[model samples]
Target: MKDKPWRREQRFYSFSTDLPTRYADMDTERHVNNVAVLTLHAEARSRLHLALFGRDEWLARTHALRPAKLQTDFLEIAHYPGDVAAGVSLVSLDPHQYTLAIGLFQDGACVGLQECRIGHWHEGAWTQLPALLLDRLQRFGLTEDVQ
Candidate 1:
């Protein structure tokens, strides 16, 4: 679960939002739980979608946008009693899907990295994303030039 160099830098993310850390999210080790961090990433991703498509369009189910695959790496333990900055960027885009790169940052350092593939499904098969949607997604690409 090695993370790319740019994934550790919060400035590289095109979209970012702060999320409050909850006391219940802590584990027995006194660190924030991995599942809780993943939930933060999900919220961050939703923000990105909301920003790109607005609330109504984002919530619409006519053209379902669902995660097809996900890969995550925990780089460091996040402590409680502080806000976590969840960042998201469009890393890869295709005709039918796009990959979102997520970073969870605390105290100016990234604590985790996540890559999720979200796709549009129509009927029983994959469908091409609308050109307007693709155009909107392109505006939120990661600032870093990563391979």
Candidate 2:
């Protein structure tokens, strides 16, 4: 299988926003605080999830997918008052788990990247993955070979 691109496939659901760095987002050296990166990740992921699974889906599902782990890497520093373009992608799909990637870009350059592993609860416990959600995610462009 071909390796998935570092970026999300265009067909997959995506959410973009201009995230403004606030005073609290800056540190002693006047750069965007490190914690802000995680905030951006959360925003991107939330937007994507809400878009794919509407509010009703959340209320109706017995066990919804939740983030099991997150890994983030920062490539550059962004200062307060600056705005970043954040985007999210569903990159991998499995029977019980899926992977999502998010990117923060400034001035057309990527400054940060994050990947998350998500899992669903089944049979009274959380499992590796769920086939039903995987199939639904595939329609949004996630694939087995994404990793």
Q: For each candidate, what is the lDDT?
A: 0.84, 0.69
For 22-107, candidate 1 gives per-residue lDDT tens digits of 99999999999989988988899998888888888888843588888999999889989999999888878878899998899998
TM-score of each: 0.89, 0.74
Q: How does candidate 2 score on lDDT?
A: 0.69
* Cα error of candidate 2 at position 17, Å: 3.1
The alpha-carbon lDDT assigned to residue 63 of candidate 1 equals 54
Q: In model 1, how large is the Cα lDDT of residue 129?
A: 86
RMSD of 1: 2.0
As for candidate 1, its clashing pairs are none
